[model samples]
Target chain A: MANAATTIDSPSEATIRERIARHAGAARVPDRFKIIADTSDFFRVDYNDVVVLGERAFWIKGYEKEGRFGLDDELKYWVRRAIDLADGTTTILKLVFHEQFETRIGEVAITCFRSPKKEARILDLVADHPNFMHGRWSRDTAGNIIRILEYIPGRRYDEIIAEYGAGHEEYFHRFFPRVLAEYIELVQAIKFLHDHGEKHGDIRRDHIIRDSERQVNRWIDFDYTYRHGESMFGFDLQGLGNILIFLAGRGDVLVPDLYRDQRQLFDTLWGEDLNISYKNRVANLKKIFPYIPDSLNRVLLHFSRGAELYYETTDQMLEDLATAQAALALHTGRGS
Target chain B: MSTQTFGDLSRRDVERHLLVAVDESENSKRTVMYLADFFGGLKDVFITLLTIIPEPSEDFFPTEAARAKWLRDRRAVMEQAMAGYREILRAVGLEDHQIESRIVIRPCASIGAAILEEQEKRRCCIVVVGRRGISHSEEFVFGSTSNHILHHAKNSAVLVVE
Candidate 1:
């Protein structure tokens, strides 16, 4: 039983609304944007909103916030999507939203933060690089960055692997070599960033979009950064390893999933064969799939329990991968 | 001063100089103790206590004042720590002139690289550092500063005191 005129509301609803309004004021593009309508949930505007940047007007269409389920309220509110009214092309609009977090890899704890300006700087640096998403940015009256990134059309490599139909054996023999080659190219692109004293910060399977039209694997999302220290690119390097495991295993092949699907293959795996960081997951794929060469398995072992030495740079990884490629070539020749 | 040539060390006219890189960690204190045990009361040995304070990137802080405050606080802490280290070396019979204390505040990507650069500039025969005590997994992912110094230091003998 409540008062007749009293509208029920959460305790923090008013606070959230106030905070959002403050952020929205800072992110205002002034004469460039017109708010057509408002979304019921997070985003600032609804469908078909008009945003004028310089001489171009983009119509807000759809959004692609991948971590919608996990993202905090503050983060979800800043990201947006729009389509170019003149060219009929889509673009991702990222507004400034600051967040900092501490993460550890083994014993080393690192402080990472979100920096929209840094991402804009990276975009400018790699503007012509084919393997990276292209974007241009401008600052608002409050000095908050507003980036308009070209929405590259393609499916994520993770989804591509998840929907792949061929069995592991067939895929390994028929297409794994090509996958390896493409991965090398991807690593080279990362090396380019490293050479320029920059880090991708976030490197995941889904962040890699395979643009079939461009025939390139383009990396997106560069807003994350960490305090530079002994392990400057540790997060990115680890992320690359995870992606390799996913692609090589033909998707995430968890221990329980493998046991349920193929008891024989699961039986072949030992505790040491699993990833030390992720003990429940298989790392030594050569144990289950014997066709996986020892050289490549050794590289994978860098992320597993059997590792003697880990890669310090992309150059070392590339060198080891080249050796694996040579071995694969010899094996293929023998099979022919 | 007596010019003594240690085993396999090239003959030199000047006194032997050692560059000891230190921070405010317990491991650094241990390294200082180890140096006192070995090189203490050796009047000919010159020790340069070097501490490199990496200036925080501008993007790391919300404002210029915050970044400046961080740098100032870091410099103050390191300066005090360096003074204590200097006192310990001085008590061990090393003259005040023989021990040179340097605190570098600059944008550095790698502390190991900065140490190596200082070693090259100062022409120190030996570079000493406390082992960072990183686990195998940590070493694999983040890399070891001591390991980097060990492999990359040129024209200077590296001593990683554990």
Candidate 2:
């Protein structure tokens, strides 16, 4: 296997030696990438680095550039301060920078460290999401000062979802259930955010990570998250429905049989005519899954009702899913 | 947890000691200086710089053989970092007898936890690290590792130098 360290350009043997010597000198090198200090027991310097103090661990990130503009420094500061206050156990630090001339876009290098208590929390979360992949970050002192952390690994969920296509039952069988579960989870998570007076303005597959092993899912990239009042219900509902429709199938294919049922339920609650769009979505689902079973279609149709009629609150939909799961269990002798 | 107390001793009374950590950034020189200040000198301090080799991702390449080759290439880079750390120590006047260093390859998510585990097993008294400077906004959005260590260094004192 290729060594993980080999891919990146770290300090070289001679460079490290030179750095040590330079640090010992009174006149310091002004290069953006030069080392600043080297002593008997510790080493300190800048390397496109950022420090995040978490409740559980301290995360140090290293980047390749100096600084950037257009980035929300204020937001970053607030988030760091908030994490420091929310809990005292885990911390995250990131290193990012843009080119000297091109200050609009920048690159990111992140490191995460946790205390024992926070470490346990991370371990448990990772364990639950076995499919989730990450990079290794830590401190190493064999000869010189070094810290390492793992970067996020694997293909993004959106890429995988796009590859599979929305209509393929095989794809749906493998990922749809998880996607549905994620939608529900997102609703709940968003509710939590809302209760806390936060609004995740941007909610999409790119923001959510999926782990296949322990069936774990998480939302990230809160850069666009915001705070809005309860009056934002219309926005939230529109976004939710759009995401569901997008995930279920976009064009003329068979909408998941379960979702068809959900549409009817949604209509009942909202007292709105969604027949045109519903029919189009069902057609799209059929095209996606040509051989979908009639019985499954019935179930999907039933489930669609929840989307149309009963989903005034996120909980209402969750409760309906639970009831449906129990009924399905009695019918098929299988429980999720 | 059982706390083992050792009688207070002068700096001269303490024997040889080693500090192990990784240089995630290219600024090992700065990190080294911070360590020197933290521990008083490089005379009795043996620093070991190490890096972990992560498992190759499935998308590393198109074929298994290609992926394997890519991994091999990556390993070479990690080895180079290890060598660099060794050279840095030598330039600072740390003899082989005083400092022993190597790079380790392992697949794990939490590198900080691993370092602490090794420190406890080795019974080290201090851990010296370099601090990453991040904007206040980013820090609040994402937590930091150095901050975590600052709060939880129960057995060993963590000296975070910028």
Candidate 3:
């Protein structure tokens, strides 16, 4: 009879299985548990840490990316330091391979990393700059690493809008203030990075970590950070403008008149005569966001006016943002 | 050039005199050659060669005698390189009176600071430098000296030749 295990259709699958088997043999897991499933992306092993080592154990994430990139040792040193400084109630360990596993011990989540080098730097930065991020790490059986982040535990603003539907003008009134606050905080974090001579190149919604309990939202992921002194002010502002458009829901509503006003101001101050491509995109803004009210769109466009003056300095931008926020509050009677 | 007319020139106009800055690397030779070609006809151009020597740290301390010997060896090397640069200038048909060369020895840690100090003292208009590859620290992913000078120098336009 032919061996059923070796009868996999794909060569890649077979290779992955072989690699996982080798790792499983070397892995320090209980003998009662075995390698239940394996793949090129990850390996799922069944093992009881309690039975083998007299401790509650969980699954180990065997990563292939770690094997390819190898360990960045310098980064690991920093990661270790950040973890030590973080809340130590949960057990978090750094593993040899490049993977992170997170387990919940009671109420607190334990986060670990296989290669702590890059992620550790990120964690340190987030901890030092609370306005920037909220991240943590933990380790797993078989020496795999895991990162247990506080899941962004709230609904997206757009989702909330859709769920409430029509006949919910009161709901809109209740949520608008909170939405504006979130936008202001996000902009503040961006300004902070700029003031510190750094550029947070990636500023997507996914990268924005929100903690509703603390009424705080922080920017995360510093892999794309560039020293502000080295990059052109024009380029940085361009990125900031693009991020604003992205956050405004990519044309789901009317292109805010505030966006247009800001673009004009940006052009005048920065001398950034955006090419035909950008002009065309901006001209057709109404098509992109049909749902947004004309008044709200006008406010959005006004919000961009400060962006034009971003080239002066981050401090100036922050001051402008504060003024704009005040004006917006007065107009809306939000009394912020 | 009339003295009264010279005074009438704006700061920008006076600072337009191109100053080519070079290191002691092999690539600096190419940089010098390229700069010479670029500013060949410019009348008020000045070329200054600066070499940053790493100061003896605790990890690299030498005996008194060894330090003296090392200084002598470095001076000899610098003298030879200056001679080669003079020949390069001559071969490129640069007027002997128009071209000026100086070899500066400064601490490596403050190379950027030294360059800025020299530029201010010399009233340099534009700075021509060689582009270096990745460094060990990864602090400045691009050429460190060029990037530093570009950021810190208020009056100079930096031209980095790869």
Candidate 4:
């Protein structure tokens, strides 16, 4: 069976369409296409399926597995990988999916939604810029906006951190400086977007990929948008804090679990040091890791429940981050 | 022992509630004019003018006094506009009891979502908004309030007046 499929030439669009109709319900039909997932019948592309948009057709290779690209699980239903038949290059295909929901931070209620159209706009603005995913979009027969992004091969930043296999104390001294340098670059990239009047609505540890070829962090996914006009970039600011906490703490330090298992570390932390949105997660790392300088710990406090002030803009944050970096240089003589 | 049925039409059953979301823009005045020309002098229809003032969090400003002063100034301006809108409806033969004005001061992420919440709370059957003449590029990137309402408002008929 493998030999027979391998011998066959790349099928035409018409032939591929017929195979899709023939194997409508069947799963794993040899070399034929199978609809691996369907979302409310709005989008139904799957492994081995051919997606035609405009004059170009892309042959589906497989669905991008969750955590592989740090792709959010919620977005998995609409995102897949394919081989661009024209150029024989790989691409990431993002299908149109509508999702809107609300969340609350203290007294403020925020409405967040998925916007493929906005992402397409952002791609155009950052087409030539490094440290951003490159892509273009087109409408399908159903009027659904389909985005084809050139694939960036690399491990997610979180995946790299997890593979480091070092204790927090060792990682802090040996590798934390390198992470901070990369984070500074990431901040500049975000600043570029802000300068262009765009926001990377979804910023997380997994969304940043350490490109194996370029050897730099490249941010992916800018489709999430939240309604907060008072501070237009408020959501992205909070996202930056979350990444800092994740990177500094070496991962999430669940306070409740710590209290139950390791009472000593839990006893050191105050209730006010917890994240404003996630009450059980610790935000102030200095209480546990005394090695963390006061300069840097002060920045993390802005995202905590006991915060007296909040970051208003990226420029403001970069100023404080510079001070923190200077203090780190004094101690370790590494990242000055 | 008493069975008296006289067409079974109560005041509540005959009333049609409309929630019109407005701002200080000139387009909002046109919306009011359109409403007056279409549904004016209708005894059974009730209109509620809603103006949402998104109050930023205390931390958003440099000082508490700054935040307080900003809120006070914003409320004053919006209250004046709401009063004017209320008068426009009253002039069209909508009785004092039939016209209601609401100025909400709260931390709202989306004005469109906030308006829909009030619509659901007041059990309004129709929602009215003024088109802002937003360009396609601007609407594609920033999203417009009217578009958000037209897409997300549930169980209510939405009307957008230019």
lDDT of 1 by residue, A29-107 (tens): 3334343212222355655455444334456656556742235233345667876544656678776777788876534
Task: State chain A's TM-score for model 1.
Answer: 0.79
DockQ winner, 2 or 4: 4
Per-residue accuracy of model 3 over A86-172 as CA lDDT, tens digit each: 222222222323333453211223232223334444555556565565555433333222343333354333334344424334333
Write model 4 residue lDDT over B1-162, tens digit each, in one string.
Answer: 112122223432345778999887789988998999898888777788999988754433434697799889988888888888888888988777777888898776678889999988777889999998853323322347897798789988999998
Indicate the TM-score of model 1. 0.82
Against the true structure, whose TM-score is highest? 1
Please list the C-alpha lDDT of all candidates, in the order they appear.
0.74, 0.41, 0.43, 0.74
Q: Candidate 4, residue A323: CA error in Å?
A: 0.9
Clashing residue pairs for model 1: none
Clash count list over all predictions: 0, 139, 28, 0
Residue A249 of model 4, lDDT score: 83
lDDT of 2 by residue, A89-127 (tens): 223332111111111101222221112222222333343
Stretches of candidate 2 above 4 Å error?
A: A1-184, A187-336, B1-16, B36-43, B59-61, B136-143
TM-score of each: 0.82, 0.33, 0.46, 0.62
* Ten-residue stretch with the least lDDT total in model 1 chain A: A1-10
CA deviation > 4 Å runs, candidate 4: A1-42, A65-75, A104-109, B1-162
- In angstroms, the error of model 3 at A18 is 30
Kindly report which residue stretches of model 1 are placed more than 4 angstroms away from their true locations once superposed.
Answer: A1-63, A68-75, A85-88, A105-108, A256-272, A330-336, B1-13
Lowest-sum lDDT 10-residue window in model 4 chain B: B1-10
* Model 1, residue A192: C-alpha shift (Å): 1.3
